[model samples]
Target: MALYEFRCRECGSTFEVDRPMQRSSDPADCPDGHSDTVKLLSTVGLGGRARTATRPVRPPSPFSGGGPPPMGGGGGGCCGGGGCG
Candidate 1:
């Protein structure tokens, strides 16, 4: 079952109705004996528990060499052949 809200154009009254989802689009009679009613848009409220999966831990790769090399390892710079003089 679902709850739907409706507004009566004749009396300018708003009300809620509890009925099956199949009859949601059916015409609704106002409580004040008004027949000119329009179904009002309503927000849906949901409650439940969400689950998350745990990721597996991975070991370090052999190609990484544990960490980066020490600074000033002597390599070609922008001037090439380390000739920055």
Candidate 2:
């Protein structure tokens, strides 16, 4: 069984239901006893994660060292003498 989302037109309330895929598109009555009900868009569940073919890759960060390189003079301390190295 799959979980589906629904919206009640008469009560303007949204709810979820668990049902088979075949009945996923069927109109369901509001639990509040209203006749005006409509099926909302469905979203893929956690089970869909197993269907992914490849893992997404992320780019490397440029400042992994936490500070910029030293200036021209090797002995010269960084800008404000703040030990960024």
Candidate 3:
């Protein structure tokens, strides 16, 4: 059974009805005996227990190694500083 929300055009009142999914489109009468009620589009509630079929894998970010590279030139030691002979 599915819970459906409906609004009465005659009394401008809103109410909910629990019925079978096959009869979801069937006309529903308001609590005040008014026959002018229209079903409303409701958001589905999963009660915070929704699960997915598979987990999505996120692409690796280019800046994952911290920030940008070094500022000026100057390599790391060795022949960069003319220390090799």
Candidate number achieving the greatest TM-score relative to the actual structure: 3
Segments in model 1 whose C-alpha atoms lie over 4 Å from true places? 46-85
My TM-score estimates for the predictions, one after another, are 0.52, 0.50, 0.57
Q: 39 in model 1: Cα distance from truth in Å? A: 0.2
Clashes per model (N, Cα, C within 3 A): 0, 0, 0
Each prediction's whole-model lDDT (CA): 0.76, 0.70, 0.78
Where does candidate 1 have its weakest 10-residue lDDT segment?
Answer: 61-70
Better of 2 and 3 by lDDT: 3
**What is the alpha-carbon lDDT of model 2 when measured against the actual structure?**
0.70
What tens-digit string does per-residue lDDT give for candidate 1 at 1-85? 9999999999899999999999999999999999999999875544455546876767645344443333565343444234577
Q: Extract clashing residue pairs from model 1.
A: none
What is candidate 2's CA lDDT for residue 45? Answer: 71
TM-score of candidate 2 to 2 decimals: 0.50
Q: Looking at model 2, report the run of 10 residues with the lowest lDDT sum.
A: 73-82
